[model samples]
Target: MSKKDTTYILNEIRNYLDKFNNASDEYYSFIKLSNELSELRTTIQRIELADASIPYINQLKKQYDAKEQAYIALYKYIKHGLISSWYETNKIIKDIGKISDADLSNKNKQMQYLNHYKTLLQENNNIIKPTLKERIAYSLSNLIRKR
Candidate 1:
């Protein structure tokens, strides 16, 4: 994923956690983190192929998967009232699981994108070395021209 996107996701996750209450924080935090991770997964899928760093991408994917599993377990525990509300927590867990699973498939797409970006980079090294500012300018010019 792009650094900006990653940072955005991390910020969102942090924001969600910051608002968590110890009384119900675990459940709420898990749900928020899961949702952010799912969104990151989607964003990652879109740019994985464009990134030059495979190891980094893989690392992020692994981290996201771990977090997802953690959230799932937290949800289960909350659902059972092992730590919190049973019925309410169970309902939230079920909802999060359904949406999270559907969105989880994007991780595979991110792997594909990563591979594609690697290949493109290798094949066109001469054209991909512009500084970030230059790239942004070029993209903006193109956008403006299109408009």
Candidate 2:
């Protein structure tokens, strides 16, 4: 990688980290929102077959989907940056392309885990409902433990 590319990749990594933190917050909020939506949907389904409240539920679902897409994109960008940086630092002059090809295979596996989590969330939305406050506390605890 050129020096400029490397710098750009580093900045991208930082941006990804920041976005990841924000996504974590959004994920928690989405969980709460999903729970509320689930309850509302259930109530609406019970009370009336067709109602205006359905749109609210649909809107929340769309917001959750958008947030999920953003999270996936940021995760891919960060993982790509990491692997590309690693390959650039370690590969032989003539083997850089091969290195990237191999690394991308591994990246695909990493993404599989991410996709699995996404699928799990979609399948059992209530299985992972960490409140925003709980997420913040968990993050702070993890940061402190790292130190």
Candidate 3:
């Protein structure tokens, strides 16, 4: 994928993060975030398929997986009525916005930023716990599945 495409995806991620901050509807915020993440994932997949020889693709994939996991946790929280603060994510978005095309062109620098961003998201995930509603929902789902 071109740097322009990556930059656009990053911008979309930033926009969604900003929306998540002030949005009254948690479900809408979660859906927007999910779509942005999907776009990012698709972009990464295209890059990997285009050039499997790219040494940094694995690192990028790892970062993407971490982000997906973290976001899944965030979604769970959102579904349970526990709205997460986007302060840390917004900071990461600002850092991403500062990344120049030169930085994006460099595999090591890109990996470094991606790894750091993934870590920040993971930290936020660790801080969030599923609300009682989520636990109850899970239990109900399990019971229904056993039938």
Candidate 4:
């Protein structure tokens, strides 16, 4: 996919939420958001697996990496408090053991899990968005391992 795809998808989500109106439009918007998020997830997987020696592909990858970081920062800025609080996120994990048989059918429990899941997405984005030093170290390790 083009480098702009993910950024555009994220911006679409942000714009929709910012201008959100008409409760009647919510159902369709939610469905569209779900599909876009699914697509974004797939695009992320592809970005992670992409490998190339060509200069153009390498350049595109770097641009995508930068864009991803910007997109994440913008998302956090725009959707402040949309992600669950860190304490709640941690508490949910702790409380999971109290859940008998991991019953997800309970709407309240399910909402907790969903919030926890979104918190994880935020945390995972922070963790996985590699820094230049980390990326260089990874490249060196790969080269060493191949020898």
Best by TM-score: 1
lDDT winner between candidates 1 and 3: 3
lDDT of each: 0.53, 0.48, 0.62, 0.47
State the lDDT of candidate 2 residue by residue for 1-147, as single tens digits. Answer: 344543454454455446557656755765665576566556555545565576775765676566567656655544444333333333322222222433434445443333333343344434434456655665576589799
| Clashes per candidate, residues 3 or more apart or on different chains | 4, 0, 0, 0
lDDT of 1 at 81: 38
Cα lDDT tens digits for candidate 3, 32-130:
778877887887889877876666777777777877887898777665343224444545555565666555556665445554565566566545455
How many clashing residue pairs are found in candidate 4?
Answer: 0
Off by more than 4 A, model 4: 1-52, 81-147
lDDT at residue 110 of model 1 (Cα atoms): 43
Which pairs in model 3 have colliding backbones? none
Could you tell me how far off, in angstroms, the CA of residue 56 lies in candidate 1 after the best superposition?
A: 1.4
The sequence of per-residue lDDT tens digits that candidate 4 reaches over residues 8-114 is 43343344335434322544554555566556666655665775346655665565566566556655433332222222334443443333443433455443454
Better of 1 and 3 by TM-score: 1
Cα distance off (Å), candidate 3, residue 34: 1.2
Error of 4 at 132 (Å): 34
Off by over 4 Å in 3: 1-29, 82-147
What's the C-alpha lDDT at position 139 in model 1?
A: 60
Ranking by TM-score: 1, 3, 2, 4
TM-score of each: 0.37, 0.28, 0.36, 0.23
Return the lDDT, model 1, position 28: 71
